[model samples]
Target: MISFKKQLLLSMIYTFILVLLFQSTALSCTTLIVTPGATIDGSMLVAHSDDNHLIDQRIIYVPAMDHQEGELRPVYCSAAAIDEFPQYASFFYPRINATDRGPGYNTPGFPQSIPLGYIPQVAHTYAYFDGSYGIMNENQLMFGECTDGAKVQLDPKPEKLIFYSSELSRVALERCKTAREAVELMGKLIDEYGYYGTGETLPVADPKEAWVMEMAPSPDETGGLWVAKKVPDGEIFVAANQFRIREIDPDDPDILFSSNLFEIAEKHGWWKAADGHLDWLKTVSLGEYNHPYYSLRRVWRLFSMVAPSREFSPWVEDGFTRDYPFSIQPDQKLSVRDVMMLMRDHYEGTEFDLTKGIAAGPFGNPSRCYGPNDGQGDVGNPNRELLGAWERPISVFYCGYSTICQGKADLPDPIGGILWVGLDKPSETLFIPFFAGVQSLPLSFSQVDTAQFSRDSAWWAFNFVSNWANLNYKAMRADIALMQDKYELKMLELLPVVQKTALEIYQSNPDLAREYLTNYSTQNAEFLVKEWWNFADQLIVRYDDGMFSEPKKMAQQVGYPQEWLDLTDWSQGPITYKKRN
Candidate 1:
């Protein structure tokens, strides 16, 4: 066995190598959970921003299957690494194969996804909608994932452990029907087998409840350590690539954890239970990555927005500040639209508004994707190693895609759950509802090759619009919102009528109900993707050369905003031709 010193040294060496090859998995991802009672319709919601580097943006469908008693479920390395290793995966994914690569490898890519281990298979596995992570199963079990960096960064080696958060969530979705079942199952698996990859927070939700489960790699041979706390039915929970579960209390029914959780931490000197109950974040985590406020600022913003009466301050002493509560009751009950608004934010009205700064450019586009390493290092800052960091907003320009798992308790699983998928940056996307009943998605949704641009992929259409909007964001934003409202509001009204029809069909035959629901979902996606492509073309003509034009009029040259013009560095010489020539 390696000594403790050797483990720490090996982890650091592995981490340094990862940053040089693959960008840090700690980049950015915001995930949240809204409990049933906190939502206006009394439905649980789990939302995630798949904000990683070069991710496979396609959404794949996996149908339920029966298994033999003696069958063992094969587990591979992380599926999250699909962002880079396309060869390790088939674009035609999860459905066709049993041992398809798990997005579980959140560390560096394996040369090939050879299985780390296997577990006993259940008699029946439910169908699920999967992106990089398993979204929702036929039972309405859902997951929202965020990768958080920890002090112990174990390399996902062959013999030690294999499952990353994506794979763990996928397995949970296939096997469990409720949030409690998932948390318990995941904890049991981690105890018996092992977990690999970086620190991860998964908001697992079902029609009845939602829970925040946080996991980190164990430094010893035990595999992994995990802790989960159920968000109260009357409150909401948010995690932005950091552990939110605190105070390991075994007696608390709301909290669930592994037996060796504290023992592992104590052995590593991360925490000592003798002092008090273990503080999970302070003990097990590296706090935040990239910058100090990188995680907290987003977390604070969500709390402030949901319950403005609390007036949560944007400022905190550091990332570990106790200023923000783990969960909170909102000022008003939220709807699915309200939750989407939470996901699509750039801190617009607040002091930290990304669109208001000089860096936002002349058009007020809030995309600040450039990293500290992009330019010369920030020589002035004390933490010279970091160089600098950007304020990561909820809706980021680099986001591959996002999902809101909307789960309703009043209806059956098929009708109760909708995996609302947005292809690009949340700010630039129109969320399309894909019901749990769908056995297949529109083929266009699964046909993305990020290495090359293609008209065949639905993701590219939104990608095109998002990238193009930067040219004249101010003019184009309003134009985009018009369409957003047109479809979204219409869909909002259309959903109830469709639900009524599906329910009527369900009474006679479940198969027919699924068929009807599937047609409505796939057809809407097909129509929306085509319309969005047309919108992108219209945006090209309307905003060409920084001019604004519509169907009946000639192009109008709308100059830069006065605020932008004033902020511009004319000192570099917007030189007068009379003087210079």
Candidate 2:
């Protein structure tokens, strides 16, 4: 009774599901999804789960500041900012100096300044944004590049510009009465300090509105001397490992941020005059030829998804190269979903995808490397290899491993607004909402230690479901979808109860909110585990049926490709124009 088309669809779906299950356990790739709303749990918290031993722990990195008195001083600072009100404190591990008697290696007089700031003192002064695991700041203000070297640690520069340190950024909490004030303050600080950051985008985020500031290095400094400009409002932008700011909007302050972007390029002779105007993009990319691999590919991938009409190739070597642009503001207003999808995406459709069935071997996987043990799997191309071990392909662990809190005193009673969307393999993972207001995380959530197999952690939970689904794809896919549907409905059903309970506690006893959220998380984790196991078992049985004989199974496909349905489509669609060979 089953149609061939239906059977084919089911088969494909099964294959895709199996891939998810296999990959989930094979490595550590997780996506951190966040959503915001006003709640009693306070403002500005980073909440998520992770596989590393450093999970749920606060991180702080401080740098030495040279005082006008010619003395180097140490300052304590938060890894990130928690609340944008009353006080500015972060849940960062204060940097400690470690010293050893052995001459091999001794901790320096100071701990590492979480080492990614345009202004050094700002690392301690203002909470330099920490994206928990991968990205420190969500509004696209980030530092630290993914290179195959020991983690980088920057020290003080000879010419101290402004006290425009990251600590000075804390001034936003002190001086800026409003968001507009904060923007103006940032601009002034950049003007004074020279905006020295080694990130793709600039740091621009408050609790309400966020902006991306992209910078380009000056030609004289071997890509060292730099200036940054802010991204415009109403448009969503993201920068991953490469510069993203593009175009000069002289008319709109909300749409751009360039520190003498035009004047400096022309004044310094870095940019050639074009029709009496300096060509910014051309000048930036003159010496830098690896733009696609270094940066633009991510932009093309993201923009291609939200607006598929644009034509850009992730693999092809176009005239474009590095120093391409600092920002690329699209012509449309980006929605929350668009931003979320962009953040969670990988190089799936592009030639860079290690898993791309087509042209994968030919083009090579940018996400891979030559491993010490070649037996682990395929080794990446030598020309462009990614650093592996301790690094994730997409680094989703940060999304689930850290807790978002504003300040220790202002911690939300029941921080319930945690959102974790397992983009690459979300179906296998259950995004349990945890609140900073809670007293303790479940023992299982905290049980992560070595990278070995264990079901007591969030990583393992994903591993469990994904591993089983991998063995049998089609049946697992349907089962996983069904479970997700039920889980979503249950969440919808429970949200009201949770909200009402939170309100009641807020009125009667404020501290009780944490208890409610804590209990809710523990119970939710247990119940979801049960659901995952049950659904996984159901697939085990159905997948054993292998052959497509059942009519009920055949009817599930609704004329769509099973593989395409579950993807977090960052691209709009297939290009309408045929390739001209």
Candidate 3:
């Protein structure tokens, strides 16, 4: 047994670890929503990044099921689902004990039979794609979530709080078909069953329209308070772990909310009649969760890039600043590819650009290694954690996976809805299409054990290439870009044919269409993933020991940039001998 003093020290360390782990998945995500009118092809799009260290990079298919009249839908302890997906264990010890990445790292898998509780079930549930959160469903209803900061963060309690944003999203996909239907159902469930976990903003979209719904737990933790506003057609919305919905009309049809939204605010002294309508951020959110500019910079950069003419100042007070609009209309209509390009941003060419500083080193790498004292005030110390926060860019290197959900009104659901998935970092990943109608996903997407590296994992394939490029990013990136474009462009070129063939087959036999899509999707994923491993190997051989090598051509030495070398303090190093002139 441990001594009391030692136990106390261990307790403190455990608490600190818990906070870090929560912030990793909860506060680091970024979201994007594009309405049909804003896109070139009139496709509603929702994109999300599961930006966390050691997050579950896999994507699975949750099949449609029909239940008995009295059958209840199990509400999973999503916070405790690490064993089922095997990702929760990767975050440390907060999840399924069997797969705990701790001392029990190699423990056998255990079934997730017990749930936090159960909710009223629907007779018929829809088939959908599942990732870190429930993704798109068979009906083209899709969602993307960003967990933000709030006044109260609660763990899922047995009877009081049973739902998290992840479960809410999965349930919505399991039952709903329209954007309005999903928002209304989630708000009702939160009010009746209660909600837990950090504040969240989910970008919900269908072929017809797109909307963002924001939710936060009530001060008393009695239930959840919420509000949602539809993204006006012709506009694009971005959610970066902060509440962007402001004053609620309460009367507008587009704005939906929990009944107690105003009452809870007033009761908690977060709102007043004389103070005017309720402000979601002022009343519920704790401003920016992490550090200043962590969330806002991402929002500002995305908006400014799409609508360059309507520029917004990058400098904002915090996540609550009104400088950035809730959504903006792009000057030009965007394509699916254009949206993909936008998500790969690093705040380049702006003052806040992550690649230009001395901190980026000689290779101009934009990836910032996260330190513990990032959000907390940095005390001047030799410890690296106290060195202050880095600029959190839209394209994060730590991202487990990122997705773009495209729901088209013109085509059938099978051919129309596509989940464009990219493993690892958005900057380096080649987006692969996964059709909503596919019966199964490629085994590589969900078969990995994150505790160790496996060549069979598609995530590892992209992850290997990305982590390798960090060493000589400025040089090796050219080859990475070539590999990415070679396959990605090829896929884009074949998309028309695949859709046309799939649609024709879908008209006659829906099952065959699904099989065809599954084969195509699986083949593309497997083929590219295989090639990617070779790509990684080539990068090592070509850039070996900081030299650029090629067939026939002699190996050429690569050195540091003149600008980086000039910035160095020569006197800090041993004296260098120079030829006397």
Candidate 4:
């Protein structure tokens, strides 16, 4: 039997250990949205380093329309379309849409065909050109997550192939003089040959601004294939796993984009003749069953936060299902900040949030689930819990056009129009501008793999800082915020200085530029390590129950909430330094 004081200490230790264990077991990745718009040229390409260390990059793209029969090729395309095509597209284009085997068939039988020697397979792959990888092009702009309406297939054409590269629109724009001609040509190509990825709805700043097209594969198609619609001007759209461009307005060139919506529907007799506003997309394709529940919640969350006037709550379910306004015209033009926030949003302050109180609220912690409190839960149906770690990673990868422009040949160097792909984990990753014009990177950035705990890599720095903060969320969140503020300011201060110095070196000596960027990377890594250590030290010293006694201050350091203040008694039981045997 333990003494009363010892028992109290043991209880506190046990609770702390349990919570810490929960935290360790609960962590998972978050979703992020990349918004790099399309470019006519294939110069700038950027993607998040999937390895998390930012060493190995993930390149994604839509295969060229004409090259469907050739060897396997990859291209960057839209986000929502990709999700829809693989995870949800099949739900729409069922073979039952055709003759004989109709709706009652249960499973939609779609066909798969590949031209040339290219055998189709699905699983994420690196988007690349020639051989080398890492953002080496200036024209590679990848914008994703254009929330559109639902898609369905009244008549399934399993043999029809599709393209998914976002650049198809831009390619059309470059070939055509006006937007109308561009849309027409794009439609023709898509109608003749299907696409394989999400179409990019490009709005570029240039001699020609075009909207790229994209589409999803029919249920019958092999592993991976997507199609895109011919983009029309003056008719803006939104997308979130649902098809956006539905009907083909052949006469109204200003209000359509697709290979041939009317032609295809007519050929298959999928569209209704009598209609006030015929949603051909719904007629030919499929709409989200739980539009509000699964699809629009993301958009509603964004619009609610950025443009309150257009706000729609996920919890506010009404009688009318599809009656809610579908498309929203932003009161203001989209900006980088808007894109960034959308990518980082976690349904905070909403009903859908998976992390509010461990039950099924929306705080959506990426690491752990709420039910059972224990780490392990049902494996097959992880979604039963409030927060599903495996289900949703915290930050989704973001690929968007930066205001900067650079040429392709110069991308091998980080300074040249190098791609700006990055992990969208807020306060954890920095979007350091890599210009096509710059010559090199700081040493701190490149030389990081060697660092250990004492020696910190940029990857390790963020992991340590974020994990340390999570140790006592009630206390450490503030410290984490404080750390972010200081770190960002420091980065802002250092980047320009580093940029200017590196530019000067590049002009004087190009070789020096490479060395400079590499060094800068290292220096940036070092700065992060130094700051993180200080923050971690504060956590260790303050929470150790030796140098400090005030549980409130400890809470402050770890970022605990006010409600947890009562829990302070747990920390005050007694400081035990005994190591677990």
Candidate 5:
């Protein structure tokens, strides 16, 4: 028979496990938007950080294709899709190897081809020159997404149709040439087949314009309800796991949405004609507005960074009163580097800075290894009860990958678009430029093994350096940032020359231009990987343990911060040892 004490302990353990399971379902991602006029180089920019803990992400290159008439394209669901929509038995089929099948339907890591549905194929699919989590086609069109879950009753109904946000983004990239066209196509597809993902925000951009669209599953489980708002030139927008759109102007040309957007809400009793005007966010949001810490804090952090002069408080008793605009015009034009820096924000110098307190450890690292208390609560000790709150900074260490895509109208499509990509934590990794005309991806950028270390893999290399720096961040970050600046600045400096040369080659032969751009991208990636390895070796030797090793001199001790020392109880700490004679 078990003791009473054992029974109590078992009960507590079971409760913690339940809490962890609940928190794991929360979606986390951030997307930043910039209009062409808001950027210094006249490029529309949209950046995203895929902060999901599962990190097997790698760069994928999908070449353009031309199909004959009477051809049909099969749609397959990924492991993520299956996990997200378990009710759809089709997505849960046995995994198949891409090696066993032919081309045109497979994606890297998503080898399992469980045919979910089929869509009509276009006559000609543009080249997948540059791409990220979503898609970017040869015409300088790109899409980025952030999950903003809707009300519980609005969970996807798999029986109607099956196109998740990712698949929709993919199809749009293949079929559409402009931002408006993509938006129209997406609306048509979602309306006809239905949308099957959680609430999502997609920023679709071309060389000339960009639009922010928010879509949610229909309450009646029939289809999707959505609204797309165009970001005017010289303005910026951002979304971080929460709906940002407030009201809609149905007749406005800049606003595009489903015909049943308001009808569905009214039919389901989610809204009423007596409510005056339809507010999409108020009606469709998952009701997370009352919880500031989970989502609103991120929105506040982003707004504060882009427009510091504006008074935005991270903490407020009620979020409804906080009238933060959907988009804002910056005081000055932003640069590509500025967007990259914004992706690396950690709420520094703000009241919510995670690195400033005792929770940051003695080394002052801004990052936390995992979610609060591993999503568990303590019942045995009241003092140990899980707070379950951590600052959701843009540049967290566990991010799978992050991307900044630039679409410039002034240049040719091949020379205009640039996808700046980084693996792991954005703060620790360098953003390498991948032009839209590049033909092939480097081997280092295509590594798939996330479970084990590989010296040849770029993701592993950056993770290695980042993990080490987290050990003594305050002391070692200077060295890491110095190297980061060196590589990033050099890449920025070479951009103009690269574009000019590619244009010159394109004037005579376009194929030659593609080859040159591809070679330049591959070579630059290889060089960056080699440099990171060298820097890793130097870091290992320079900061081993708690000492700083000099090249030709004795090592120096690096101690903890004075504030950390002061917080410790050290009344009997000074232990004196007798020196040996």
Candidate 6:
């Protein structure tokens, strides 16, 4: 028999534990969802920035698998996955085998026998494609996710068997074919196995359709509750580490969700029938409103860029009542170039522009260095003082990897999907296209360790060049941009030719088509890396110590902005008439 005091003490301890768990697993990421009609080429586009606090940003490729009926599969989690399940160590190795060889069947085994351990296995698995740290199975079913914290109690408690978000994504990518299928598959999995990580918003897209699904674990700790809304054909939607889905329409064929989404919310007292339709964002959100300066500002910035006519204030004080629609009709149809440029936006020409102030330093660099608790503190807590911190822009410098994924319905799946990946900040790195059907990834794109600087790694190569340009950003950015535009334009121009050739070959021999694409992807990636290395050398020589080094050209001197000079309280007066005594 337990005493009343003992019971009370245990309850308090459990509450404290939940609080700690929620704080540790908080994450920030950005995603952009565009429907077919919003795009110039009638291709659905989904862009994601996997931003974290200094995690390795290597591109992981999981080859399609064909597994036997009874074979067991191992599930591993990312380093951040440990926060939600502290009992489990971070699985450092690749979750799926890079090669096709399974465990027991190596070298034509003497007898097919199961290993002496209990391992979980799915009933069956399918072939799929993955790129830019996200999954896009061979079916051209692509998926990307952003993390947004939910109610603290909804977080997975300690020592529970659950699936991390990344693991769930990998499984769905491997198993499902379309956006709707992936959403339903993930929902089913979460219901049975339970979701273990922080809240997440996944933008799942196929060649013909796109859906943004917001998910968070239920407060009952049984499983996750989710709601997915389809992006209308002619609309565009963006999410920046925040829930964007508003009302629910269960009867709508476009909107698919967990069966118990509203039931669980009502059970937790987060929803009411009188609220009319179940509001996923309002019901599941961690309840930080009135802090537009936090995550909401990024949403505002994106809306302002795409639909300037539809006014959205970054300074909105109300939290749940934000008038920003779930999706908006863009001012004009967008191209791949327009979407890529949007990924590189930093609120230029707006009041929240990170580049115009003294924080940008003398070179007009929009990048700002973030410390622990710098921008995230005010997200779910509006009372926290901002202290005039620089706005969190889309093209941040510390992103591990960013991708612009395109799914086109007009062409064959192999020839349609393209993953335009940038190694670092989109503004600094070139988006080299990797076709979906490529048989092999470029060596330069694989096995990157961000901690060590290696010339062979594409990520390091671009980072080296971008870091050098940052030194004399104001002076050197124009040259870099020129090179960027030239190379990217060349790739774009060559795409049609490559696609036509590949399509003709695919009609004859799909294998031959894949081989052609593999060679093309590898060649372009290797060439881009080689060119970036040369560009880095040129930048060093041209902007050496802030002076031009061309033999025939005079050195170009640059000065601080007059506003900056005035703010420093320094004099621009001529040298004193009399020498200082």
Native RMSD of candidate 5 (Å)? 6.7
Per-residue alpha-carbon lDDT of model 6 for 32-141, expressed as tens digits? 88889998889888888766524545565556566677776555444344332222323122222222323311212112222112235665555444432355756678
Encode model 4's per-residue lDDT on 143-202: one tens digit a residue. Answer: 222322223221222334433333344343223333345445545545455554322223
Shift of residue 41 alpha carbon in model 1, Å: 1.1
Task: Please list the C-alpha lDDT of all candidates, in the order they appear.
Answer: 0.78, 0.37, 0.78, 0.36, 0.72, 0.70
Model 2 C-alpha lDDT per residue in residues 472-512, reported as the tens digit of each score: 44345456656665675567467657767776786778767
Q: After superposition, how far is residue 175 of candidate 4 from its true place, in Å?
A: 12
Per-residue lDDT of model 1, residues 1-581, tens digit only: 99755754564465445445436432458999889889888888899998853556778777777899998887665545322222333221221133343232221321334466788899988888877777889889999988776767665555557667777888898899989999998888877777766678889988888888998888895568899998888899988877888788879998988888888888888887677988988887767654677778989999999999998898888767888899999999999888888898999988888887888898788987564363222111325465556677999877988999998888888887888999988888999998888777887887665656899999899999999999978778888888888998888789888888888988899899999999999999999999999999989988888788877886887987777777766544647665543
TM-score: the better of candidates 2 and 5: 5
Per-model TM-score, in order, reads 0.90, 0.49, 0.90, 0.51, 0.88, 0.86
Q: How many Å off is the CA of 273 in candidate 5?
A: 1.1
Q: Could you tell me the lDDT of residue 448 within candidate 6?
A: 66
lDDT for each residue of candidate 3 in 1-581, tens digit (9 for 90 to 100):
88755753564466457545444433468999989999988999999988864445667777777778997776656542221222222232222222211122222443322466678888888888877778899889999888777777676666678777778888899889899999999988898889887788999989988889998777788789889999999999998878889988877888888888888888888888898777888888667756667788888889998999997888876556899888999999998888778888898898878888798889989988755545442111113243467888988987888999999998899889999998988989889998888877777886655656998899889888899998898787777778778888888789889999999999999999989988988898888888988888988888888778888765788888888988996435656576433
lDDT, residue 451, candidate 5: 49
What local lDDT score does residue 244 receive in model 5, on the 0 to 100 scale?
78
Residue pairs in collision within model 6: 128-137, 128-138, 129-137, 129-138
Of 3 and 4, the candidate ahead on TM-score is 3
lDDT of 5 by residue, 1-581 (tens): 99755753564465346335533322467897899888888888988887754423666666777888987665544333314332232221121224322232243433244446667888887776322245577788987777774763233443465666776777788788899999999898888877765677899999888999888877667667888999888888988777777778777899998999888889878788888768887778643421345567777777777787886777666544345678888877899999888888788888878778888889879986554445332111223434455667888876777888888898888888888988888888889888988877787776545645899888888888988998788777788788879989999999999999999999999999989999998899889988998998988888887788887864788877778888886534756575433
Write the number of the candidate with greater TM-score, choosing between 3 and 6. Answer: 3
- Stretch of 10 with least lDDT, candidate 1: 88-97
Model 4 spans with C-alpha error above 4 angstroms: 1-137, 140-142, 145-193, 196-214, 219-239, 244-248, 252-256, 266-270, 275-285, 289-292, 311-342, 349-355, 358-424, 436-469, 489-581
Candidate 3 residue pairs in backbone clash: none
* Prediction-by-prediction clash tally: 9, 48, 0, 119, 0, 4
Clashes of 1: 9
